[model samples]
Target: MIEAFDLFSVEQVAFGTGRWEQLGGFARRLGSRSLLVTNAGDPGDGGLVDRTLRHLEQSGVAATCFRQRGEPRVEDVERAVAAAREQGCDLVVALGGGSAIDAGKAVAGLLTNGGSVLDYMEVIGQGRKLTRPATPWIAVPTTAGTGAEVTRNAVIGCPEKRFKASLRSELLLPRIALIDPSLAVGVPPHVTACSGMDALCQLIESFTSNRAQPLTDAWALHGIRLAARALPRAVAAGDDVEARTQMALAAVISGVALTNVGLGAVHGFAAPAGANYPIPHGAVCARLLPPVIEANVAALHAEDRDHPGLAKYAEIGRALTGTCDAASDAIEAGIGCLNDLVDQLQIPPLRQFGLTPEGFADLVSLARKASSMRYNPVTLSDAALTEILQKAW
Candidate 1:
């Protein structure tokens, strides 16, 4: 018998090579004045942002620009919300990488909910529910990773508390996700590698998550296949439009899959690592993914060899290596493939990001409390978690 499951996703998705040109028309339908959230540094030599402003203006929608420098913080969301309110902006257009999109999502939620980020953020805050729908928001991704365009939660860090958490609600889903693969054609190779690895990790984790269901499985598997074929090409050649398009599609599929099934250990560690250290979110995932996979496979082998996740791991291996071998062989190949990818990408180790044995105990404690940990296929002991960290280091 099939199990019952629920799925959530963005209301609309406009994905293609030249879909960005439709942004102005989409915004016109949503609202008149827009809060345009983007990266602090110019993309496409400042032409992208300038063109976006022109598009909105041509479509008769006024815009006020807000540059997001890094990951979204509680204060940053508040400041953006204040700006939106002050400018009477009724629409939000997030255009850039994941950080900017997340910032825009949080601002849109707070604009209508009428409270500080702490009022609804999980773990580090009161964890209250949002009672109202967020303002109409559109996501225009310039990077082919993060898939923040379709996700329903915004990750916000609290520097004072030294933690990061999500301001989560179904209301935060974008009104439309407008993805134009051409926008990502000029992304730096290093950024492409990091983000592509992050997307791959999300797909693998979600596919093997304890909550995995048929719907999410379909999306995850397809995404994993696309990433397996496209990630290396995308990183090696920035101007390869076909590779960029494939990666972009894979990223959106990953976001949809993860939103429904949740993620596993790599993301579990990401929250604590990103909050306490200077590591980028993608870099953390890249550095830790292989070890976490090894740990989980070992735990499953020792205790629950028949776990569905084990077979899923073999499937992932097949996807990555294009091997039609037995389950055990396939799983090993998959793990080996990931290790090779990490070395090829040159993802920095945790130690390079200021992590050490001295702080392992603290990170383990915090990771245990992370929301993503609950979705790990097998419940791991603290010792196992520490070993994973040690291996990654």
Candidate 2:
């Protein structure tokens, strides 16, 4: 009954062991000149970036690098745009985590239709549309989370707005996203848990979001199963290549699903929390997952004792915990997962990022405005949101 609206999009996928070898060919086809965007010298990631550039060189493409030393900042985007324009590079390749990928999305969007990045930023700016397709951008994920490579929207946090939003458009998708799990193997345990949760959240939220479509549901369910199995293995032992490959698949699947479907409460607050505090994005999401699920379940029950959504929660429960016919067990499954993950990795709460009880008031207010919340089954009030924060805290 839900297949009324037909959607079609393009995503060039190159994935496997040694898939990095294909980067040169994709870059050459995109353009001779390439902008390799990355975070500043993550000692672990720096060498990989160099090798990717060499691949481009071998492919007969010239590469100019724009290093993001910190998180992706407005100035970084500005400079990347300038570098790409100055070099006349027709292709943008993001090589690291979400920061570089988002920066590349911004650069590609602005490359064709020249304007301030703010103009295109959803909610914070004029919310202008990206009418033209950005230059051919290739996403190479070096991390196992965020799935920024497959998403059509780029999340940019704006401190001035006290939140973040996506630079969303069909045109913003990468021409090709290269998923080589070998590149994600060296991730530290803490980063792995956090990013893995982020991937997990994307899949779970996409599956449950009000905007989910059939195609998106396929990605979400597959991503959910793969992540649930592989994330723990990847965290327990980082060098497991098969686990990493499955995780890579999960992240990419979640990314594509979130790109096509949407997300729920956990992500609705991630940008606000990340913008206001130094807390990592995935950490914020990881902490919020259980309470948000409980809240959603409680809200659903309150709205209707017999809603289909309640049954969906039961479905999620069986998927996560293998529990039978227990709708509220989904909330339990979410809690068990979060607690097990946190204890395994011991992720810190918002307070570690300096969000005292006093700061949370403002954070809740800011989080309330984030557009991602619109997809949540129930729109949480200030008090309700604070309750979730307090529980996570």
Candidate 3:
């Protein structure tokens, strides 16, 4: 049987050591007036807000900066949209981590579309399809994680609803993705671990996803190999340019793959876990990935011995460990390798992050409702889900 799928990515990707130097020229082509969104706590840190403004100024483009304080929220998008509208900005440059890029994607969509961010969020909002083209947005990632630079959806956390949802549309894809691995040179080791694990999980899950297609599979496999070799090195020495560049490439590949083929239980659970706790999205993914992989393998074998994802896991095991084994044996070896990586990264358990058994019911229910859950190779029962959570705990 033939499977059909669609691929979406940013229009232009400029990836190299100092590609950020081209920002001014690119901004001029996009628009004369721009809005810049960044999550940097300080103006001088990896937060390139001031530098981005200088680039736009040098290009003769008028620019305004909105510094996002934390994770993207519904309120952040609302405020950014209003800022863009008031300043009459014509372009948006998101230069930071995932939060800034996600927020910029939302603001760009809402700026031209003329609606609140809630009008298009999944599960909790009207889920209206966005029809208008977004204002041209350029994404410059300061981190090597959360390929929001290329993905088509912005995750927004709504405090009032106590849930995190995504504002999605093809229009939300950025006009350009400018990835400079040098920007990640000084990122803290802890942040590196969490983000790197998220990138790795994205690659592994997408490769074995129910929606996996030949195109995504190719990307995922390559990304998995890169991440396996680079993530540890990057985490150990943040200044290692070679490792950082590989991790960045792996992250972008994972993002493109997940956007097309979808993710699995780790992200499915992370969505709700992140909303209910103060944990970072990447941290949530890191904590849950090993258990989710183990559970998926067990469930697939117990329920349907011939499910193809089982073999895919073996392939993943081979890709990660560079060891050849039978599919069944490889799956166990892969799980062990993943666990080793998790410990090496020092990904804390859910308990340390405030996920208690009392919260299990709501977490499981919300996890199931997440759109990502649909792509898991097997439908996990409530009991199975509980077991996975407990194991992670």
How does each model score on lDDT? 0.91, 0.81, 0.88
8, model 2: CA deviation in Å? 5.0
Structural similarity to truth (TM-score) of each candidate: 0.98, 0.95, 0.98
A best-first ranking of the candidates according to their TM-score comes to 1, 3, 2
Could you list the CA RMSD of all candidates, in the order they appear? 1.3, 1.9, 1.3
**Model 3: residues >4 Å from true position, as ranges?**
44-47
Clashing pairs in 1: none
In model 2, the runs with Cα more than 4 Å from the true position are: 6-9, 40-46
Sort by lDDT, top down from the best:
1, 3, 2
* Clash pairs detected, candidate 3: none
The most accurate candidate by lDDT is 1
Alpha carbon deviation, residue 22, candidate 2 (Å): 0.7
* lDDT, model 1, position 30: 96
What lDDT is obtained when candidate 3 is compared to the true structure? 0.88
Residue-level lDDT tens digits of model 1 in 1-393: 689999999889999999898999999999999999998355445578888887899999999888898899988888999999999999999999999999999999999999899999999999999988999999998887788899988999999988899988999999999999989987899999989998999999999999999988987888898998898999999999999999999999888988888999999999989999999888899889989999999999888778777899999999989889899999999999999998888888989989989999999999988899999999888999999999889
- lDDT of model 1 at position 193: 91
TM-score: model 3 vs. ground truth: 0.98
